[model samples]
Target: MNFVKRAGMSLGARKPRTAALLAIFVVLCTLLLGGFLLQSAAARQEADAQRTVGVDVTVRKKGLTPALADRIGAADPVHRYSPEVPVRAEARGFTPLVADVPAPEGDGAGQREQGPLAVTGVRDLGMLLPFSYGSTKTTEGRGITPEDAGRNVAVIEQRLAAGNHLGVGDTVHARSADGRREVALKIVGIFQDPRRDQPGWAPPHELPGNTLYVPVRTAQTLGTGPAKVTEAVYKVGSPDRAGQLHAAAERILGGGGFDFRVNDKAYRDQVRPVQRVGAFAGLIVWVITLAGALVLGLIVTLQIRERRAELGVLLSLGEKKWKLIGQHAVEVAAVALPAVALAALAGSLAGQHAGDALLGRQGDEPVTAAGAPDTVTAPPAVRVEPAAVGKVAGIGLGISLVSTVVPGLGILRLHPRSLLTDSE
Candidate 1:
């Protein structure tokens, strides 16, 4: 009989065993394709969300100016940029007794309990409200509004209020580090910092008790320099525009030593959790693939022993050993072809479901306008793509070949005399 006919007959005769092996291959392919597709989708979603990660450009030695901020605000793709002055101001009529202040820049450096508090004054003090991540809002009263600017108004952190025995309708008076500037402002609201991380690891100023939020005008009154604000914040739709933003900033600042800090942490935070998931999923897919290959190899190896008599008969008729190996390889490919098709269908559906589950969670910002209201929704999601299908099909074929070839080697070495003689 021809090798193709022989392979067909052998597969047809063991109907139950063929079905069992076919099911296993299908499952293996399905899991492999599904995992790969889901991983790719997750990575793509992270990349898309990356566009929303805001950027910060700080003027270390040279303070930011209102004219530069206005220019940045008018720039294309730059949304909701703000000018701010971060200053060290001493709190009068109150003393900080808290011991949680972090070590300062230099070795063993830290603020004395009697030291001045770090204050940030912004044009949009409300933007620093709790609604924004890396920000906080009032737990008691309310966040500072635009009306607070050009007035003696401040938003006190809850910790600051607790330490000072103050609340809404109270006052927080402070003098700038140079003592040349001083401001006494009424506290219209009290806020609580997220303080998610331990104070030891966070930036010293980010600590709850250490900061005070006020109007940009108030900051200017408390800070002495040619420039009014210290830094300018820009949300330029996507991080890929870093170059454009840098160039624009340089043009606005007349090309000095200004520094731009890209805040890609939004994307990082979204992806970091899923990265661990992707790595573990990738490892599991490979392990399962290897196990499936070994199982298929063993099944093929055992088939050689069972069909020894038939194989010997063919060998006696002058059939080459390679022909026998080719027959076995052909059979594995036949089984895998069907499995790959079925897995493609099953895996695509399963993978999309998994991808949807991984895309976002609570507190995640959508890839749209910065500070966009809920009315502006994210677009529809893509379930699957052509590249994913091609990858699965190609890998499935590779798996079929590898699994067949490994055990086909053992089968080809069988001696015809031994095969014909072995009755069992």
Candidate 2:
């Protein structure tokens, strides 16, 4: 009769042994599929962390010009760059919030009594520390954007706006401390500051409410000499890319007084754990596949020993030795297909829960250490994909083939008479 038909009949006759093999296959396949799912999920989360919670590289020097800042910002690894220039201006018609304590008697005390407002020129207001940290928020109109680079505009604190009966679209005049240069800034936005005035002696400009954000050109106009930024900050996609940014900056700024500080504490606290999980999941996949193959190979070898008489009778009847191996391979494959299906079902049902258990659900607020700002990275969740199922199916087939074919090699050298004597 045909070997395929005989293989089917053999499986039907041995109900208990077939069920045991199916059970083992299901367990092995389920573990392998789970490992694949975890690996996929961890990789997705790591990418998200890299994109949103990357390292911040701060470049500080005495006089970092915007021209030099633009050159360094053009690097391939830098995502964005912000150049800040701080200048003092005395309010023309409105009073700024001041500390309650009396002014100290000193040589510069006369200038301290004036309490000029602190005007900060920025390429992008949203990238500033206070706004980025959520400590300050625009309550009316809009914050200064990159498009307002050369425009004369300002976004002032709401407290200063309300005290002076000012609102958006109103014009505010500011004169430089030297009284040589002045600017008429249109109030485009009003922001809210959570902090209050300090009790100890401090200048009016030092108060949070007296701060003003203006375009880089407007602040530069009030300065005496060449346009220069106080500091420049460049953002990179990940901690690893900080080196690339450093090299780029060196090409522009060179090895001078410019100091580069890289802050990657947030990346370390969040992204590193996800990376480790991905690596561990990959290791688990190889371990389970090798162990499953070894266990199944041993099982097949013992069954071949037990069926020596059956094999000898087949060989004596002029049956081909390759057909005997084919029958064994078919039997194992029959069990493997269903086990893969069962594993797919189980993975779809419990993949997310298992992932959450392994990689704990991350909080909305990124973990910050050593004064690092909170990042906006959202944690990724585990999901089932068709590709993962296909991988499990392929692996299952490989294990089945290796386990059956390696043990069947012993049958080729055995003679029919020797097999009959071994069975007797």
Candidate 3:
């Protein structure tokens, strides 16, 4: 018979065995496809979140001098840095809509309880670090601009605005510790503070509301001259370079009596919980895939055993051992390739859904007018490039061949004469 006819005969003769092998291939393909999909989705989300939020490193001292900030920025290890002075101030005459509990009987009633507000005076507020969350959501008007610095213009928090019925173009009063020289500032913008939920504070909406943004120069005029920055934000080349930059920053600022840190570690810490889930899923996929491979090997081995007599007959008739092996390998590949293709399509859809679910759960606010509350949207379809599919096909074929060959070896070694003579 011709090679095609012989190969077809061999494959057709083992209907049950071929079916079993196909089933196992389907299972393995499913496992691998699912694993790859989930991993790809997670990696994409993490990368996107990192870029969007960026990172922040803080340095605390009695005060920061412009000279120090400039020196740190100039460091060879540093890429770009912004110096910010954070101060607590109270809005005078304007009581926050939220009320503080009355002081206990023994507490000094005369002492003025200061409402906390975070006043960040930066040189170029926009360039130092982009205000990502609150610009368009302004309840009344625009965000702080370079012109606002030293001109007594400030941006207040959203909760503060809600409580006080304050809006853009309204004037708010603030005073330093001396209280003798109070500054009346115009409210140009109202924003949502990203740090509202920081430690020692309740939820942003619940906290006795206090937050404001102003020009760096205006901050100095209000109280302490050229306020010291507690933290600095940097824009580096890439995530891979973050470590090198961190090391460089540490070396430059190590002994300067201030802490030098990177935003990556903090960000990773915050997302550790989600990462752990992804890791666990990967582990499960590995276990399942391995198990599927072993099971497939065993089924192929059994099929080969049942066909031992046929293999012996073929060997005696001058069928080459390599040819027989190749025939069986082609059969497995035929079964596996189709199954993998189907599984990959299904897995890609599932991955897209999973990614959307995760992002939705993360509660990302919508970029909308009137600051409409964010709603979860379905994630885009998972895209697998032609290159990636080719790689996966190669891997699947390799796996199918290896599983078949290793188990078929037992049947390939049978002596043709011995098998033909044995009458069962």
Best by TM-score: 2
lDDT of 2 by residue, 1-424 (tens): 7888898999999999999999999999999999999999888887766665667788887667988888888899987667898887788878877667876777236655443688888877766656655677777888787788878999999889988999999998888766787789999888888988887877777888899989888888876567778788776878779999888888888666568898887678767888888899999999999999999999999999999999999999999999999999999999999999999889889988889877677536543221123444444676668898889889998999999999999999998999999999
Residue 337, candidate 3: Cα error in Å is: 1.3
Estimate every model's Cα lDDT from 0 to 1: 0.65, 0.82, 0.59
In candidate 2, how many Å is residue 226 off? 2.9
lDDT of 1: 0.65
**Model 1 Cα lDDT, one tens digit per residue, 102-177:** 4556623344322357777776543432334534545666555555667878777777788778988887688865
Model 2: lDDT of residue 228? 75
- Score every model by TM-score: 0.58, 0.86, 0.66
Rank ordering of all candidates by TM-score, starting from the highest: 2, 3, 1
Highest lDDT scorer: 2
Alpha-carbon shift of residue 379 in model 1 (angstroms) = 10
Off by over 4 Å in 1: 54-60, 63-229, 234-268, 356-368, 374-382
lDDT of 3 by residue, 52-72 (tens): 333444454455565566666
Best-to-worst lDDT order? 2, 1, 3
In candidate 3, what residue range of length 10 has the lowest lDDT sum?
366-375
